[model samples]
Target: MYHSILDTSVEFIKGVGPTKADVLKKDLGLFTFRDMLAHYPFRYIDRTKFYKINQINPDSQYIQIIGRVISKKVIGDKRVKRIIAVFKDETGIMELVWFQSLKWVDTNIQVGVAYVAFGKPNLFNGTFSISHPEMELYQNRHLGRGNLTLQPVYNSTEKLKKFNLDSKGIQKLIAGLLDQVIPQVTEDLPQYILDKYQLPDKRTALLNIHFPKNQQDLNAAERRLKFEELFYIQLQLLHNKQLRQLKFKGASFELVGEKVNRFYKEFLPFELTNAQKRVVKEIRIDTQRGVQMNRLVQGDVGSGKTAVALMSMLLANDNGYQACMMAPTEILARQHYASIISLVSDDLVKVAILTGNTKKKERNILHEQLENGEIDILIGTHALIEDKVQFKNLGLVVIDEQHRFGVEQRAKLWRKNVIPPHILVMTATPIPRTLAMTLYGDLDVSVIDELPAGRKPIETRHLYEGQRLRMFGFMKQEIAKGRQVYIVYPLIKESEKLDLLHLEAGIEQLSYQFPRPDYQMSIVHGQMPNADKQFEMQQFIEGKSHIMVATTVIEVGVNVPNASVMVIENAERFGLSQLHQLRGRVGRGAEQSFCILMSGNKLSKEGRIRLETMVKTNNGFEISEIDLQLRGPGDITGTQQSGVLELKLADLASDQIILSEARNTVIALFEDDPQLDKPENSMLKAYLQKLQRGISFDKIS
Candidate 1:
């Protein structure tokens, strides 16, 4: 059995005592041997060769040199001492200077002693020199593997330094540990499988990664590990998909009769976009089929996805089954309830709201109604998952802004009923088609590509810090026309510790500029309680507050048709997709909306490019594509987002084609010999077993 080194205490390891172990545990979170093993080198230092002192040009880059100290002199005072030494190599002579460690260097260095010095080469006056260079005493037997190859450099805490354990010390410890852990190369995979895939043994790969002799070995080790990590993740996802498909069947709501048709003809405020109709049709067809529906409906902000969701819920109600919509926040859940209540006949379709703040009596009543199938649709936050809550024949479960929830939470929802409800996850963030395919490979996806009639696009603009006065004047003009405004800051509280700007300062500045008595203003941020945030949001939505200065907490939920202007402070601080989402909060109504991005004068090149892109187009998909190019997939979806399949060797952005090929290879192998009972297929099974740690691939069987 393979053992984790994390089980061993740091004190048990050689070179680490009680004092050092305490520092490691408290400061670096390194309590065991495995922690140090996993703490991979941040960078490598090349010490392959040494340069002659005289041969070194003034403009030459950093190089190591072997030289003998000819003379040493103490120049400066005790408080600011400087030790200057003259050294001569085979080619020429140079000066070696030490600043703070003069006493140590003076005692250690002896005239005519040959030693190795490593540092950057620079010219001062007309001579070549190295200041405060890292040096080692010359001894043929004590060379300590002098600059022979690349050396791993680790990261250590200041506390470790106090205990005489720094980066170099940690590196030596890891090197010694590698020497003791004998390679236990078990044949987890068949020999034929290893040959076909050209994979190294697991033990060899692990050892080489920590102590590689050359670049080729490092590359091979990395390839093996990355592939193994991604393969296991993919295997787990595929297995989950199989288990879900086999274990649960959705209640198919087939009829599209009076209620859906009546709402479409009379109650619907606007005609359905062709994209919306297509997605609705896809959902209807999926529900009609006997299998559980796991689909993702992605659309750009303001693309009318909520309308499609409401229509699907209506379909379920007509077929005599209850449906529920779960949002990530209370405001969003309330918004959906209000919007749907306005569009549907309340008598025909009963709707209820359940949030964390719901009264206990009300919750009990709602639970009873939900369990008895009296409520047609229930909308809420995560409180919907409480053990007390039950649904009578839950036909459909629509998750809004699905990325906010984790995989385990989604799985919990699926288990609420014996036959899992038809799952439709919706997101306003428009992901590119390629990324969508990998991230949501298991789910059938539907896209809503159009907005409703009279939905005007917001005009976007980028302004430098110098143009803030002009932007303020423009905001005043917009406010004069009875339009509300949202001025968003980046932080919640003013912190004396941080050098960055805070939201409280922005609120103070805006209050001075727009002066609260003249224009009513309110502030909201994450630090505020939920009720206070909702109260401030309510004031803005009711037109009681003319200008609301808040943080990105308003990015997802707050919907105000009257708010015509969106001003994002420190616009460069936000990611492209986030900026787009914030911009989407406005332009919800017929009145033309404006998005003003205020950036600091000193902006990064990428930041400038991001701002320029935001000004160029309102298409969230285009912005997402650019974001993928600039920041990569990890930042776009966040590292923990469920749909983001973590890859080891392949980049989801750059190596899409390669990933497709690998996926195809796996699929073809599985299809040709499902159980892998044949000899040729047995190797593939071995490869899968080596890759998928605990997850099983019995779906093929």
Candidate 2:
């Protein structure tokens, strides 16, 4: 078998032997020439400007200087060991330091030798020193504005630093390997694509990406690389989508009959929002086509996603098929079961609820009913995915807060029916359009952007610790109005590392303020036993308690219509997605609701932005876009689980336009040549086939 030149091991590269290559592999996951070339810089520093020691200040930017080393000394013990070299220019003297590669630096630098030094200057005591300076011998090198102006900075670990493989070291290795690899890089994109998008060739993009002379070239490089990365990802995703259609013979609920109509007219909790109606239509279109329905339903809190899901299940029931909805937690399962039960007539469709908390006798009866086809709809947590829990004629499977469940867990439900059941995964956490495109690109997406009628937006506010008294008074006033409240903390118990408000302390303080019988309280957290937690939650649900003190367990929970106030303690500690989800717990009822984000005065810039973003808008999609920007692609909700966004250069937050164009182009290409059998797209077809087999495209794509 032939291999690409990029497959050449990094150990074979010049200046990087076996020992250094092993270190590189361990420290930065760089094992081959391809990985090295793909390691793009996070940022760049201009090395054009030159400065003298006398021209430096504490606040000066990264500067380059030419100086001769007069003296060098090793200082401090083993842990704090560092090399301090004094360099003198025509004007004055400045300190050059190396704390990482001490021995290497000590051996390399010669006393009274002229060298070019570049690094950010920092003031230690009274002297300005450049730590871990990039140094090269000054022989006949140009003194003013050298040709290599923009220098790339790659990420490196502390261990890499010890091996002299810092950002500077990695860049040096890449600089040497680029020439050998550039010619090997091939153009995988079709000529039409290249011409239409005006994308540069593969070689030009890779060349300029690592070592661009100017910003314009860098932008062009990024544009092309980002397009290729996203293009291949979408191509693979679309291929899978096409294969899924070809593979699975799905349950076709052709009859939109009695149950679906009756439920829509008489039992829907509220009038169907246009978004929900449109989604139902989409589901109908998908199921009628005889292909498996793998659709993602993204909606904000109280946006009637559950209603849409229930309606879809009714379509299943009407077609003589059993439907099941799975939730992440028992509370959520029971909540879904109750809502679903209320939506459909007991005589029309039998509904059963089973959970981990269900008694053995009850579970046995439930399992028997499920297998016997007596139960038309079964709702539960992970317990529903058990081997014994068989569905008679299960057709529609709705997974709520789907991220909480694993891939295998979802697959088990698919295996329940011989023909893989129609799958509808739902989440109230609205994913950004770009993120949704990448994460659920294979699955058709239906978003419920509008909330139901008569529902008011939850007014959110940020409060500091000093305003506790005022917040307490406001809580009391709300309680006086016969409305319930929720106080959520970051920690269940005192955490030594984090200065967060523990639920224990929070409840204790609240008890003193609200006082005994006048204000009854219920506490729920993850640490509590199943029965105890459920009991507390039920107490709050039944309006037996005025306040519910808990951790984030309340985030995905049963809705309490009377609960109008949600106070999130240490709000800065929560991500934007989490903050939004927690705030969603309230504002489910007709009455006005409030989400008071309580935090310390000292908040990081990102933390402050999160709270402000929450206060600024109730739009989950907007919050998701900002969240994607703040957290990047990996950390945003469920993208990590999908593993599709393990992109080298494309950022889901910033590269929406590129992703859309690439996806559309791939889609158009597929429409023309579904099998990519066209002679015009031969290279592109071959590249995708290799990608499907887990081959790295290297810089080709």
For all predicted structures, in order, the TM-scores are 0.77, 0.94
List the global CA lDDT of all models: 0.77, 0.87
- List candidate 1 segments past 4 Å from native: 1-42, 45-183, 186-221, 271-275, 360-365, 406-412, 430-457, 499-505, 515-518, 527-532, 604-613, 616-662, 673-701
Best by lDDT: 2
What does candidate 1's lDDT look like per residue over 521-550, in tens digits?
A: 878888889899889888998999899888
lDDT of 2 by residue, 1-701 (tens): 12367778899988889899998888778888888889999988776778989999988988889999999999999999888999999999889988776767888899999998988899888888899887878884443223667778899987777767878778778878886767667776888998999998888988888888888999999999899889878988898898899999898888999998888787776778899889999999999988999999999988888888888988999998999999999888888987777777787789989888899999889888888899988999999888988888889999998878888999999999988999999998888999888888999999899989998999999999999999999999999999999999999889999988899998889989999889999999898998999899989999999999989888886699899999999999999998999999999899999999999999999998999999999999999999999998677665477667788888888888999999999899889999989888887777767776887555442
Which pairs of residues have clashing backbones in candidate 1? 47-147
Cα lDDT, model 2, residue 653: 82
> For model 1, what is the alpha-carbon lDDT of residue 62?
65
Instruction: Quickly count the clashes in candidate 1.
Output: 1
